[model samples]
Target: MTSKARLIYNPVSGREQMPKNVADILDVLEQAGYEASAFRTTPEKMSAQNEATRAAKEGFDLIVAAGGDGTINEVVNGIAFLEDRPKMAIIPAGTTNDYARALGIPRDNIPDAAKIILKNKTRKMDIGKACFNKKTQYFVNIAASGSLTELTYGVPYEIKSALGYAAYLIKGAEMLPHLTENEMRLTYDDGVYEGKLSMFLLGMTNSIGGFEQIMPDAQLSDGLFQLIVVKPSDPGNLLKLMALALNGKHVDDPNIIYTKTRSLKAELIGKSEGKDLPVNLDGEIGGYCPVSFDNLKQHIEFYVGC
Candidate 1:
């Protein structure tokens, strides 16, 4: 039986040169014996999740996402709802292919990635579900609250286009001076902790913001979620933590606290009591603080090169 490959790609990703690579990808897939078809994504059209869901329902053997983290998030969301999901692949066609990096997919070359996808070694990985208000969804990587969340919301779309991943650093630096500490009460399977914290990040994957290693101990298939909490500290301590994170050494830093849990609940406890502090899920800001996270064990499967 010939495997069918459906590609959902963002045309505007990767310096607007992503479409240029499609023909080559199609050629490679065809050579590998896949009945390949490509679809261009638009803002108003069916989302990546919708596309993936449709493909899986229509019995595509493989569904490939060819954008960045946001695109992968959608595709994962689509597959999460399927009873029998198709093996998913990544083409790493975005500016910061964070999910691709976490999966050890090569971004510099396209043909190699296509070849790997054709081979199709599927691995079952844990999925994280975040619920706030009436919105509840699944994330394959990190869900964060506080400063990083605010930064994600505050950064303009234009800046993201102009600077790529560096836009996050610039926006984060600018917001640092004015960032407010979050007074939150956190409850997890292990225990409960309450305090004023600079930021709270829960990771199912090792990295965040494309390159920052916020959760150095995170494993995608570990079946547990890793939580990193940054307490309210002196600016110097925060700076040191930031530096350590860039080097993937934040787990060892004294000021940063790391823990693993199957589930966690965060409630805001202060003057901004009723107000919702922005919470970022997989680099997209939408939910508020006081969010609950639960691990969905082996909930999703991916075609990984590693």
Candidate 2:
């Protein structure tokens, strides 16, 4: 009997190379003794999530997500809730493969990534779940809201696939001037905090948008999220914090609030009520505010290089 692997990829992801690399991907999997099949996501019909779920139900021994952070999020969400989920693998074919970066996967080389998968080592990792206005989504990397965070999703798909990571910088610059401050009360495992903040991020892994030190102490299997909140500040102060974040020194700054928590409940206050504050999960638009976040520890096993 042969083990089966399902490769679910987004053709438009990253530099649009997955479609061209399909044969090489399958060859690599075959050499590793797995019978592999492929699925290309289509905007008109099936999504990455749907294909992932179908592959899992059909009992694929491995489910490989070949795309960027958004594609990984969709595949993870599709199977994370299933009782018998397949082990996950990555191709890192996206602009910002944050999850892949966290795992030290080769982001630009698909063949090397396939070889890593062939090595077959596995590690248990956490997943982040957010619920808002009766909507729920699962994220394997990070979940955040406020300020210019929504720029991740705002960058048009074409520009992102064309220019890769640089597209985010362009969009971020365009969005920075319009950033909003939200007044909210955050209730976590230990206590409650009420204030106005430019952004708040719940991270399961330290690698986020290329800022590896943003949550330097994050532990993926710990069942807790490293929450970082940026207090309201002038543009100048915010720029300073951005520099501090790159070095993981912002946690001690008075304008920054950092802690570890397993669960968090955020409710809008003051003028933020009824407002459509953007929420992002694993680099995609999740929903609005008044959300609860829970860390699901050791939620999935992945084929990783150790």
Candidate 3:
């Protein structure tokens, strides 16, 4: 019996071109001897996770996400804790496609990816779980805090849709002058430390927004997350740090501190004086500090190119 494959598509992703490509993907999958269907996603009624759960219950052998990082995030959350999870596949139709990038999925070709999915080769990969207050979720990419997070939140959606990754640089320059360091108390599996930090980034994958800005040595299957901390210092030093990150050389700088850990907890130490500190998870604003992260090792299965 032929196995079923369901494609969850977000119409608004990647300059609003995902829907058409999803149609093409469904046709390709059907030609490859798989029972295929495409579902249009919406913020209100249906979600990628909802679709994945429904498909899994209906006995789908493969669940493919045909959109951006956020779309993949929703799908992963659906299958992460299931007893008999369906194999996951991706068709890179997003701006960054960060998770697909980490898995060696082809960015330019969709038909080829569909063929690989039909082959059914799989690999188990780690997923990171983050908690904020009463909410808990998993992310397959980086979780960041501080100035960069603020910039990510402040950037206009129009600008993001227009310039893509370049929007970050444009917004980061505007927010740099007003950015201030915050006091944080962080504890990991190794130890605890308190300090004024300019930035804190926990990387489960090598890149953020499809750019290798921080944590150059991060690996997805390594069973550890890379923690990078920028100490509070002069504004000039912070500028230098930014320049180094653009070239992917910040990890070698003496002022930056890097470590590998399985879990970490960070708490805001000092009063913000009515200022709201922003934190970002996979490009979405995830609340303030006082958040904790635990590594969910080999929690999700992925399809990778041979």
Candidate 4:
């Protein structure tokens, strides 16, 4: 029996590469001997996600997400909860192809990324479920909360496309001076922490924002999250820790909480008492915080480069 596949892409991501390379990508899928088709995401919210759901239900054996991390996250969300989800592939076309970077898939090359499907290399990737504000959202790369993390979505979409990773740097620098600590209670396996937190990251992969050292020990199929929590610190100390993170040496920092867990709960207390913190899911604002996270171990299968 011939396998079937669906390609879901964001037209404007990666400065409009998806549309231009559509034919080549489809050809690559064909070369891999799969019956293939494509779907273009619309301005209508959840477009990719809805399409992904439909395609998976229709019994496509493969789903190729050909845009940015947001597009991939949507595709994953569409079917990760299903009893029989399809295998996935990524064509990295975005400002910071964080997920692609982690997958060892080439970024900025649509057809080449699609061709990775032909290599027959694959893996089961862990997926994260975040629950907050009576809503559930899923993430495949990283989930974070804090003022600094706002940089993920704070950069305008248009600006991000044109400036790429530089846009995030600019935004980070601008927000650094104004950073504020939040009264936080973080609960994880074996222990709990109650203190001021500058930021916290739950990473399922080694790469984050184009840097791999932040979660150097992260493994896609580990069934665990590498949780990194930043304790409140002066700007100078915070900067120092960030520098250490670049080299994967921050794990021992006194102001950092680095551990592995299958689940976690992050609560905001005091000042922002009842206020909700925005949760960044795969670089998009997923929902508000006071959130709980659960790792679905090796929940989704995907074509990956070795």
Candidate 5:
């Protein structure tokens, strides 16, 4: 039986090039030995995710997520929980395309990125499962919470499309002087950190916001997450830590809690006063704090560059 492929893409992402590239992308998938179809995501909330779930249920052999990281996250979340998840591929169209960078997939050319499926060099990928009470969500690369991380969320879409990671830097600087220190108890494989923290990050891949060394110890399928908890510091001290992070040596800093864990739980402490400390999952606001994450090791297979 021939394998069937579903191409789910966000039409408005980046330069909106997917519509023009659809035919070529499908041809590339066809050349890789599959009967492929494309689905342009609508604005009807979770459209990509819904289509992804439908395609997976229909027994598609491959589900190719084409667009920015957000689109990829939706697709992954749609099927990551399934017992029999289909293999995945990516054609990046977002600003930074951090996950694609980690996969060694070409970001500038959609067809070239898809061509990786033909190369057939891939491995099982670790999926991060974040749970809040009865609800669950998933992440493909980085999950973070902090004032600086939240700044990126408020940046104008036009600026994001125009400047990419640089926009994050610009916005982060603006928000630093008024940073929000979250009081949370963070539990990891080693121990617990309960105190005031400026931010915490859980990374499944090394690349985040176009910074390759941000999570240097991250492994794609190790069934572990590299967790970094930044203790509360003034703007100047936080800037210093930021510098250290660029070289992947920030783990050695006293102000930073760096460790690896298969599971992690983050809960608000007394200082929080029951207010929500938002959790940013793969660059998007996933849910409130009190989130528990389990590293779903080798959960999804993918088409990665050799």
Candidate 6:
């Protein structure tokens, strides 16, 4: 029997060339013996999830998420809950394809990416399930929260479309002076840590927001997340830590807390009492904090190149 492939792509993601390349991508899959079809995501929230779920139910042999982290996260959440899920593929057609980079997938090369998909090598990977504000959502890469980190959502659509990832850096630099420490109580695996922190990042993969060294030790199938918490410090000190993080050496700093764990809980305290800490998942605004995360070990089988 011929295998069915469902291609779900975000038309405007990254360079917005997927619409033009759809024919080529489909042709590649067809040449590789797949009965391929494509689905362009709608403007509605969770539309990718809905489409992915429908594809899963209909039993597509392979489900392709052709966009950035947000689109991949949506597709993961869409089909993760099902006991019968299909093999997954990704096309890194986004401004910052951090997840793809970590997996050694070609980001700027479309035909090469399609060729990699045809290779069909796959691995079992972990998935993160976060419960916040009485709602549960899933993530494939990283989940983060802190001051200045919320700027990913503030970059105007026009700016993002025109300047791509540089827009994030420009906005981040502009918001540096506004960085606020988050006072919180965090519990992870039989230990409690309370402090005023600059940022808290939970990661399942080494590459985060295009920074490969941010969580260099993270392993996708490890069933544990690499957590990094930056303690409250002066702006200069914070800048130094940021620089060190670029080389994955920030863990040696006294103000930096790093560990690997299966679960964690974060609660707001001190200055964060009445405010909701903005949370980001896979480069998109997830929600507010007062959240908990659990790793679903080897939850999904994802295809990648050899």
In model 3, the runs with Cα more than 4 Å from the true position are 31-33, 118-120, 272-276
CA shift of 104, model 6, Å: 1.1
Candidates 1 and 6 compared: the better one by lDDT is 6
- Count clashes in each candidate, considering only residues at least 3 apart in sequence or on different chains: 0, 0, 0, 0, 0, 0
Error of 1 at 70 (Å): 0.8
**Model 6 per-residue lDDT tens digits across residues 152-184:** 567876887678667766776676778888789
Higher-scoring candidate on lDDT, 5 or 6 = 5
Residue-by-residue lDDT tens digits, candidate 2, 18-107: 898989999888988899999999895439999899999998988989988878889999998899989899889877788888887888
Which tens-of-lDDT digit does each residue in 145-178 have in candidate 5?
Answer: 8666775467877988888778877877777788
Q: Give the Cα-based TM-score of candidate 4 against the true structure.
A: 0.96
Model 2 residue pairs with clashes:
none
Top TM-score model = 5
**Per-residue CA lDDT of candidate 4, range 1-306, in tens?**
999999999999887878989999999999999998999999999999999999999999999998888899999999987899999999999878889988889886778888899999999989999988688999998999987787677888887777876776677777778998788888998589888888899999988887779898888898999999988887777777767877899999998999999999999877767876888999888887789999999999899987
Error of 4 at 296 (Å): 0.5
Winner of 2 and 5 under TM-score: 5
Superposed model 1: Cα runs more than 4 Å off: 151-167
Instruction: Indicate the worst ten consecutive residues by lDDT in candidate 5.
Output: 145-154
Ranking the candidates on TM-score from highest down gives: 5, 4, 6, 2, 1, 3
Q: What does the lDDT read for residue 77 in candidate 6? A: 88
Model 5 segments more than 4 A misplaced: none
